[model samples]
Target chain A: MNLSRTKIGAILAAPTVVYMVIFFVVPSLILFSYSFWSSESYRVVPDFVFTNYLDSLHSAVFWKVTINAVRIGLTTAAISLVLAVPVGYYLVYVSRSQTMLYLILITWFSSYLVRIYAWRTLLGTNGVLNAVLLQLGIVDHPVDAFLFSSFAVTITLVHIYLPFCILLVTSSLSEIKPDLIDAARDLGTSSLGAFFRVIAPNAANGLAGAFMLTFILVAGDYVTPQMLGGSSGQTTGLLIADQFRKTGNWPLGAAQAFVMFVISIALYFILVSLGRATGLIVKRRTINPKGI
Target chain B: MRKIWSTEDILQLHLSRRVFLGGATALAGGVALGPFLPGSAHAAGGDLQIMAWEGWELSDELADWRTKNGVNVEVSAIGNQDDVTSKFSSGNPPPFDAAEYNQGYSDLYIDVLKITKPLDKAKIPNYSKENLFDVFYDKPTWYRDGKLHGVPYAWGLNALVYAPDKVEKPASYTDLLKPEFKGKIAIVDDTLATWPLAATLAGFGSKFPHLTKDEMASTFENLVKYRDQARVISLTYGDAVSLMVSGEVVAVLIGWTGIPVETAKQGLKTEYTIPKEGATTWCDAWFMPPSVDNEETSYKFINEAISPEIQAKVVTRNAAGVVSSKAVELLPPETKALFDYSDVNGIFKAAPLLGIPPLKSAEHATYADWVAAWNEFKAG
Candidate 1:
């Protein structure tokens, strides 16, 4: 008639565990297995082979797009997090009303493609920005660099993912009590000093998680880059998708995907370590039950 | 110490567990059997299901036919031929009675995948040489191994489109490489349509649909030169139109005739021409899959697809060419001006509908190779 805490926890987690095992875990394992297989005439053959991986590694196009993806991902994540922090701080500590947060969330109701096209309209050669610049006589000719470049892709990605980053940042910042900031301020610390020494270190893990999540989404997005990145906008995600959709080479696509996955994992660890090295992430030590 | 439960409590617990287990089993069973259900199959009973291009549905055109036959039709629109191929090759394909494939994909669907069934000419009376243009008759892409595999419906050309106000009409694909047109041109990212045009530019036009690996590499190398002139690579025909309409690019390499019409709507006048180096053409056809449940209804649908009334509407709506000779008379002035119906054979000779690269070949580059090369070119 009574259950232990562990037993109750297991019972509560059973449905999610079963669902994930069936959907995510099983499919991921299958996809991993497929990376070692081979394809001929658009048909996948079950066999252990390193050709797909080796070929991708040796491919110039693969390396080119992978680097492009990383650049776009990192730049977009950094900008989104930077912009999100201020808004998140204002909402969590300074603001009383939830209207600002709701307005930020409302932007997501518009379609993703619509937002990308909206950026295109604002950044095009004859777009509003160019028209304003032309009217002001900023330059004689319209600038063609605004749209269909890595700049356009990054700007659009920042707009799309900023609200998501803000939500994460707000949630992280809320956990650090206002008393900590007031305490730091009372101890001769400025507002900026409190943010760096008291706030950032405490929310380091959540902030890193927010950054990495945004990075992964941006890197793996094929549609936005295809729409706005122009000739140089092609990324590993688009290349991998092309393998599956156009070439019908599942093994090659799977191999490229795993390579990107490994890169993302490595980047996450590197980011966390960098935070620690910069002293932005303070390490917590576990205490012994008895004196050592 | 164990707590004792009342008889009612035990019964309630047992009943709740049974109900949970029963619900879980039912959910799992439904998930497993969902695809094979009547409506899920898409072509249940006498209903006809087709996978086709976005505007190829001809819903309004075929409304009377549906009412007369008392048959319901369903169509799934696709963005590209790969959408259909991927579905059929996914191991558990949708139960589509009919599907459309471009000329380049006929060999793929019919020969490699073996997913198509030959048509009975007797069932489709509208799809005859007398009704349709003779230029579409007896092609190896549609008729293979002495059997009719596809019924040709709509056709179009992928050629050079330029703004008449900004630049003179290009006489050759190489004209795009001129210094004056630099940074004012774009190539649509459609490999199937662009590859043959690349071959034309590379001086291997005659050897297209059968390019050697060296020739394929040369073709892409030539395309990369055009990339230098291109300010951006448009992802779709709409993107290309947007570029021209916004004055971002004065010209587009390997653009569709429909681009000018689309741009015209936006108050931009553009023109498309088959240059001296020639253009690549596309012809879409309808074929019944081997899994067709209602062959008679499928045949009727395909028949109506190529009929004069339906063809005229679809061609005008899509800004594409019609297969039926009778449809030409029904076409509006703007739509009729898109192609030279009086010289249909000449147009075919100039920009013939070419097959895609072979799937597997010992002496030539395969479709996979072309895709890889195309990606490399795009990445630049």
Candidate 2:
């Protein structure tokens, strides 16, 4: 018997589709349903109510933490991508050895908590950074601002996610042939101009995907921020986690999570639109049948 | 031999492979579900399962007792009070024979959720009026409805932890706000531990853990002052210890008694003091859930938990107060110096073990409200 390409593709994807439906889609739907419920005395009651969402919206603390999370997320993503693109370019276009990439991947073997604590030791008042500054007479005393601030949170996040972002960027750039960059340069485009005019627009979708993935991880991270962000580092993820862990208000936590999820989707769209508007992303043109 | 196999031979091979796969899958499923089966250890009361704080497992302390009793014990470390509550309330609850609940959470576990049942004091030989300190005996938190619901095991204080080298012993909580302590203080983000101190600072020490809405607001308003002085809001007791050890802050406002012990391990000397505004205290007790399977083993475990030898070991390791009066004689010099065993009643009067805010209240603030207030303070 003969089968169409689409049919073959569907058959190949069936297992993954079923797995996702069972594991992801069903759990997500249940969590979504829980957002509409209410809680009293640590017990979640099954009832349709919008009080959780409305209360979160009206609360000043909620807005404050949400905005703080967004700021940290966007800043970390921007820094990670900016730093990743150069290393990714070197690995894809300039280097033939896979050693550097292997080294980058090797960093993941270390525990995440260990990395966070390492950053704490490096940025603490009497840390290596302060010791160096003091030796060089950069300042009279250690800078307290080096840690337990939004800056510390963002810097630590950038370090943690940079390798991941670099891998994503390299994978995206590899799909664009180095020959395309050479051709652009031959047409009188400088190295920087070639990167912008030829490579970026072609790899726009992949780049945006990498940024959004990093942003979502950073924004939803409660642990790093709690460890480094101090009072200013309070984020929506921590608040939602507290609702479930401390307050036993699962429904309210679910509502806040869904709200953050919706915001993340909106941010993704906004980023894609901005890329197109700024000509960083090229639009595809279709041929008219009448003209043809 | 380069011989072509017949169709029947191929079909027979496929049938054998299918049978092997089916049998393996069934075996795996049975192994995974064995614990929940009726004849399994969990159901047959052959093993005792406990949910408790990390150190409360008493694996090292109870080794001999467990061996003598020929009992297999399983312990699950809990991150917070709600862990046990969430586990028991879930659709398929674990068969937890025993669990630990803080003093304040007894009401929620016993009265509201009904997750716990009255303990059979007759079975626990070590849990008695003569063995336990008078302060922990016949308490309203654990003893309710004319029945003992929990056995008091360990207790601790939430006071101001300070580095003696950098700062002198603060005479009052207000000293934390002095110019000398600027950028040298940390307030822990613990609502339950902070509430009593906040109440004291708000001039409502006598009515703590049960405050009207206006009083709750005043309590947090005072907490905000401490927050302003704090260089950072430590997320946990460990975080507070890290801050103190690193010398990032000279003092921790509303810190744990265990913080000094933790920091001392890192070569940092820190001490805690109950200021004029007083401090908050917590007592942990062992209780059996209603779904307990091995009641006999569970009672033995709870009784052994407060035994003099076991209590001494636990108090030393945890840097906490022991409920067993006899345990004091077995404590080491440094462990004995942690708390004044001679004046157990005086220590209770200085910082009483307070309850969590009422779960539901019309004229007063509830636990949920206190959580929200704590979150707001942390956000700032």
Candidate 3:
């Protein structure tokens, strides 16, 4: 007898189930456990100690850095999402040329290190940006601010996540029925009105998805802050790294990571609730004259 | 289900000679490939790889001794002795077979019982009475219960470096810490190094690492004053040198070993000083580790390194440090003028090797605090 469909489904899903268990679920649980313990020399004690948690919460610096991390994450998500929406729509709908869209996406395929390094060269003290400004007589001296500002970090993050946002929004836009556009046009709606009312609502889910992913990536990154933030760029992530590496204090690092994880989870849930509320209001629209 | 064979099944199929031959061949190949992989028995050697100050690499004469003795030796050359210590503390087993202790510092807790095994002088003939001077040789800190544990390697004074054109005639070590030269100066970020210079300038070096609360307060005041003018507290000797060379920063406190040579070669008209207040000098010595398997070869390497030919080579490669009794004769006259052995005026040396407190164990927090304090200082 042939294997049942349910059995086949289980067989196909076995790889994913194993994947999550081995890489995601297990490591996170282990890391969670480590956060509760103390390390005296290099030796780790398994006892639960809340001192690390207390230290992170009590310090004004921790709070300051956490707020900065949130600001960075949200700013990155907003910029990447806003910039991606237009590009993705244009690629999927406005442009009929397959070669152009493919050419556009090919840009994202380069290594991230190469992109960051290029940006570094451009913004460096004696870099292209400064050189150009000097030539134009825009400023008297080389601009160290371009490389070592919070602005560089936000710009770089937006650049890194823009492709992801486009990929997400493009896929969502692809899911919209072509007939819906035709139906809206048949009802005498303008192309812009149809897009804002119909296509955007369908793609709201993708926008939320992109925001969620980008926020996590931006919040956890330490290198961008270190390289671009200068002395002022001391982020919570860099502090967490310091605790583990130089301080040889694993418990403290783990605790800080745990707090960050908790904050990220809370933000995710808050965004989800807000999205649900907005999505409900959008789905209630009765503007369509002849609903099927 | 497909059938799987266990050990019992394999034994039961012992009649298959072709399969047995294939298994035997595979096992032999694995054995042959073993030595080529990391952590293999043959890859495990008795030779200990040492990362050390530039003075420790090789003597010009000992290239013959090393080749003839059929012993493998690998040396990683570095500028500052503290850098070698930093690597050892950074996990992944200690870096080398043996490191030279900062002269007279063989007794420090970091080196003594923890990293190095004490030496028996009877085994190594080159460790004679005359080579190590009275200041280092007579130090009981280098000896445990009156036995020499390490062979004195190379020692030098770290001094004030300034561009002659800019500074004119700066007097004492105190001149570098002044506000007028602030942003125009570079300093080695030793965390505690400025303590000797700062303390001495603040009238407290004689009470180093042991100070009355009042003295500590004065030192802190001086440090806060010094901190005001500095642009950046660069963390490495290389960084200090770079900032100085690029003219982004002109004068720096630097290790005498490699940098003064660079200063001379650049024709920068820079001066390295020993102030009237007195200076600190330090020496590094070769130490034996308990892990050393062939003491005979190790002893030979040590003895050959200190002999006149190699000592002279060490001096040549390292501009300031004197590795052996005869190393002074090898130096060019101008380089000799830059640093002197007898002068303690402007040069600040390494702390005495032994009997000092091990630098605070959980000192990373101290660094973090410094960064925070520095940021506040800069903001102000």
Cα lDDT of all candidates, in order? 0.88, 0.87, 0.64
* lDDT score at residue A263, model 3, on the 0-100 scale: 95
Error in Å for residue B87 of model 3 = 7.4
Q: lDDT tens string, model 1, B120-186?
A: 8877889787898888876787898788999998999888899999999999888888998988998
Candidate 2, residue B35: Cα displacement in angstroms equals 22
lDDT of candidate model 2 versus the reference: 0.87
Candidate number with the higher lDDT (1 or 3): 1
Candidates sorted on DockQ, descending: 1, 2, 3
CAPRI classification of candidate 3: incorrect
Which residue pairs clash in candidate 2? Answer: none
Ranking by TM-score: 1, 2, 3
lDDT of 2 by residue, B284-303 (tens): 99988877888878887888
DockQ of 2: 0.48
Tell me the spans in candidate 3 whose CA falls farther than 4 Å from its real position.
A1-47, A61-128, A141-230, A245-247, A266-292, B1-113, B117-189, B192-228, B242-247, B251-320, B342-380
lDDT tens digits, residue span A85-106, model 2:
9999999999945999999988
TM-score of each: 0.90, 0.89, 0.66
